[model samples]
Target chain A: MPTRARRWHISWLLLAAATIPLLAVVSLFVGVSEVSLAALLSGQDGGRAAEVLMISRLPRTLALILAGSGMAVCGTIMQMLARNRFVEPSTAGTVESASLGILAVMLLAPGLPMFGKMLVAALFALAGTSLFLAILRRIPLRSVLLVPLVGIMLGGVISAITTFFAYRTDMLQSISAWTTGDFSGVLRGRYELLWIAAGLTLLAYFAAARFTVAGMGEAFATNVGLNYRRIVALGLLIVSMVTAAVVVTVGMVPFIGLIVPNVVSLALGDNLSKSLPWVAILGAGFVLVCDIAGRLILYPYEVPIGTVIGIVGSAFFLFLILRPNARVA
Target chain B: MIELKSVSKQYGDTLVVDGVDLTLPKGGVTSIIGPNGAGKSTLLSMMSRLLPMSTGWIGIDGLDVTKTRGDVLARRLSILRQDNHMTARLTVRDLVAFGRYPYTKDRPTGEDKVHVDRALGFLDLQPLADRFLDELSGGQRQRAFVAMVLCQDTDYALFDEPLNNLDMRHAAGMMRLLRRAADHFNKTIVLVLHDINFASCYSDHIVAMKAGKVAFQGAPDAVMQASVLTEIFNTDMAIHEIAGRKIAVFY
Candidate 1:
């Protein structure tokens, strides 16, 4: 029995695959350093350029790929699970919940290791996402516009709580900086948790078809013998853990998840198993482009990637909202 | 046989499906017909395990529906609800392929492909198999969904309002296909149909419900009588025999 041919479009796959390394190479060169290729190849200038490249530039680039692709995958999974195109960690309260968890851990266990902090954040994220889904189940959800609005409001409530606590504890500055989503602080050891997020993205790839069926709604999924609730739980777990990893490691990069998946689906259709690779590649490529833009925009003074994405992402999001045909599928 | 023992469903104080016992024959076209709010769809939902019975138990071929593993039951029975609005953009072929998920679990074997192709052909959907579902007309979309259910290849198949958006031509075609499925494959086909004429013409047995209880059940000829139809529907219904078939006229 020959299996149905996988719907992998070799042209798009190759193009996206090729774009990532090109962006990575360009990203490796964009920074405060003035190290030419000839200088590095000569081995003449005492390895200062090599040290800076290895320590800061390489780690930063890796962090961008991991966090970007991870968040995009998180967005894709959340969107599918919610049956709304606008869902992502930032909108869905997962990021705020992670921030709240980080703040709590800072106050309660100030000396907790990074891994422990990520675990706490991930747990809180899972709880927050569950609450969101519970709220979603109660509503009629007839309008497509209402879904993201509800999510944004939920996020606002959680963010307000986090801000209140930060204010009372006199740690608003630290908390705000942590949540700003800058890649400048992504050192070798600090960005390792995003690796776990990368692994979760792979798990999402393996479970893509189940998630697609689950996205068709509970009855459709259950009738086909897929465990709808279990699949939804798995999706939420992946979404929360990935969001937590990105939030802890590099802060919240808002719209990468929402936009990348939307763009990929627009071009390639919604067969998740076939489209996930493109989603990952485009996600990484998009972040690299944005990070480089932020770095070069201010030259010696680096602008945060979060601020850059926030501006561009919000504009694109508004376009989606106001677009004449953005009706719910 | 699909057997229900004192099955009932309630929402708070309102009992949508009253405690009723029923035993459906193993293989035939059985159409459940009722007016608005007759609990016909609700009863079908419970029998197929799509909705939990407030009390009592349902057994399909001696296996308790509530206790059977979902995959096992999926191979035995499949049900489709009225509304199937999907956010994902899926082609008809992709949608039908999902019917085999119970057996293949995402990895489609050549056998699964055969089932999908056969189901598509059964519904005459081969020409539009690659077209996106949203792009199809309402009647075409209904056929696509029926194709998916048929591709599930279960022993018993149930549908709620399968003719809701279909035109007369498509509706009649759908009924003929369902009748053929029962006759050729020896499958138990159950449907909640609003059109009494369609039921009278295509169904081997008819079950009529009123106010949450079964009012009549028998061969189509017996239930299609003017007295039974008028009483169950609370209106004037005239039954005429033509070419040895009972036709109901309620206009």
Candidate 2:
């Protein structure tokens, strides 16, 4: 039986592994400016196709893969730490607090570089996630639904404050643009920060077993000689840093984190060490496909990746909630 | 030996375990039997270093529990609580393999696999080793948890109400398993038990607590008396010897 399970996981991993490159190729070719395979291979367009591939298409594709996998892994860690399936960066106010930090930097340090802005946003994300965890600890009635509901409420409150400030400063339009998560403007310089998020994702993979044990409540981890508090703190830092990097690079890509991990866990179990690779691959594929659809849906124009995933991810989230056999805690 | 010196646990103004000073000798099954709110579980938690003592100190062997590093102590001692709520969906093998974390840090070797298999065989969990924990019956799940604890291979094992959700037969089986662990493996086993009869039957030493203090501590024959049992539980109880084992009957 264990061997059968192992074979099943390997096949799924193989399928998932094959999917990302295919989607990346598709994403590279699907865009407003036509950069065909023939054109790139034959050098038929005087290196313009090559330039576009390097400057725009390749970076955009890399950003999608990096941000997608990063966010999905972030969600996995957050769910483990929170010990609830429904919690994610978008629901937990981490993204919103990151936006608030960006807003603060825009208003206070207008000349700050993009890296500086990302640093501040990551700091705020860390603080926001910690606050959410602190609140969860105080909440005596931590029903499965109530945890995410509390996170959503916290997000709403933070976004509302952000909106109020943006409205006063006449920066509402820019803030909306930043929060909506469009990858249309991703180029060589803009999307590189997501590599840091990817690095953090690798770190998460290294620490996956600890997170799995930590997910089994504090007493269980302590019995195994894990410093429970330290593991949780490390999980939060990874989650927040990933969220901030993705948000800073490409805005808020909602539900990829929430949906991808949930779907993977449904098929595979929640042993993060075994399942994280699947989560990362599936997440990248999901985002790449969504980005391609967003580009092709309106042809010359594009729907934002956030809007596309928001629609698809929310549908899955609702299904997860409404399903009879949903394993929630 | 497990030594407690003036150990107390206070929640606000209320003290749950009050200055519990006792010594449990190594290499035998010790049962802590008490009624509700007697702090048996609390004392067990403090002894295992799962809960910080309000005042005083606890030592296992020569190492102070509060001062010892977690991973170092983990190799020597292990504890299991009655209600272990986990969100991770794991196979029985996967769960039991976690017992090797103290040594392997999640990277299991050949020797660790041997230990895991032995534990599964000991608990008769080989058939269900591949099954997910949520797919198991309550008793099977309980056995799986016990297998994980056994796989830890610690010198001292502590359990808070190990038989909470077991049927009578399964509860007796669990008691026998603990007894065998103490007798064969030479492990120090301590348990918090509400069943006085089980305590009387299986334990080498019995300690009865009442209202945050130890009311009696001795062999089963000394602590299982009708007078001492009635005083500890505050109920009318009669002792009857069945097959040379003391049994308490309270109606």
Candidate 3:
């Protein structure tokens, strides 16, 4: 029986690993410009196909992989730290806080480099996530449903503040552009910051066991000689930094964090060390598919990946919440 | 030896474990019997460094629990509370393997795997090793947790009501296992038990607590008398000798 289970695990992992690059290749061809593999291979069109592939398609595909995997890993870490299955950066005010930070930089230091903007946004995300956790601690009745509800409320308030300021400064259009996740603007130079998110995701994988132990609760972690508070702090730092990088580079991609981790956990169980790779792979693949579908749905005109994910993710979220037998934490 | 000097835990204005000064010798089973609010669990928590003391000291073999590093203390001592709720869905083997974290962090050595398997076999949990925790019965889960603590290989182990959800057969089996751990492995075992008969049958020493203080402490034979048991529990009780053991009978 155990051997069978192990075999099943490996086969699924292999399938997921093979699916990601296939999706990436498919995503590369789905853009408005006709950059076919044959053309690129033949070097036909005086390097125009190569140029588009390098300047746009490759970067967008890489960005999708990095951001998707990063956001999904961030969701898993957030869920562990919060001890709630439903909490994610998008719902927990982390993305809104990043938006607020971007707005602040735009108003206060308009000439700051992208790296500087990402750092400030990361700090703001850390603070905002900590604030959400603080609020969670204060409320004694921490039902599974109540946690995400609180986060959504906090995100609503922060976004409201950002909107009011943007309206006054006439930066509302730019703010909207930055707040809605669209990969069409992802050029070679614009999307490299997501590599930091990808790096943080790798760091998360190394610390996966500690995060799993921490998710068992404070007493349990202490019993095993783990520094519970330190692990939680580290987890939040990773989550916030990743959120900041993604939001700053590609705007807010809602529910990839929520939907991907939940689906992964449902399939693979919540053992972080065993399940994290699957989470990353599935997350990248899910986003890649969404991006491809978005590009092809309108054929030359595109729906943002954010809109595609939001519509699909919210339905899955509703199913999770409304399911009678959800083994919620 | 585990030594406690004036250990107290206070929450706001209420004192839970008040000025507890005691010493538990090594290499035997000691049962702490008390009512719900008598602070037995709180004192145990303070001793194990799970709950910080308001004003006091706890030393396991002369190493102060507060001053020593957590991993260092963890190697010497381990504690398990009654309500062990976990967000992560771990198999029994995975959970047991975590007992070696203090030594290996996350990468389990071959020796650690041996210890895990030994602990699983000790607890009769080998068959259930691959099952997720939520899939097990309460008694089976309780045994899995005990296996983890045993796999930790600490010198001193404390359990806060280890028999909470066990059926009679498993409860007795658990006591026997703890007794064997004490006798065979030379571990210092401390437990908070509501069942006085089990304490009398299995424990070498019994400490009875009342109103956040130790009312009495001695051998089980000395502490299991009708008058002492009656006063500690605030109930009418009688002691009967069954198979050369003192059994408290209260209706």
- The candidate that wins on TM-score is 2
Instruction: Give the whole-model CA lDDT for all candidates, comma-separated.
Output: 0.89, 0.91, 0.91
- Provide the lowest-lDDT 10-residue window in model 1 chain A: A1-10
Per-prediction CA RMSD (Å): 1.7, 1.4, 1.7
Model 3 spans > 4 angstroms off: A1-11, A327-329
Model 1 lDDT tens row, A265-323: 77666778778888899899999999999989989889899999999899989988888
Candidate 1 residues B12-32, lDDT tens each? 999988987889999999999
Docking class of 2: medium
User: Candidate 2: where is the Cα deviation over 4 Å?
Assistant: A1-8, A327-329
Q: What TM-score fits each model? A: 0.97, 0.98, 0.97
lDDT of 2 by residue, B130-232 (tens): 8888888888888889889999999999998889788898899899999999999999999999899999999999999988998899999999899999999
lDDT of 2: 0.91
Model 2 residue A204 CA deviation (Å) reads 0.6
lDDT of 3 at A176: 95
Note the DockQ of each predicted structure: 0.75, 0.75, 0.67
Task: Compute the lDDT of residue A116 as modeled in candidate 2.
Answer: 91
Interface RMSD of each: 1.3, 1.3, 1.4
The positional error of residue B209 in candidate 3, measured at the CA in angstroms, is 1.4
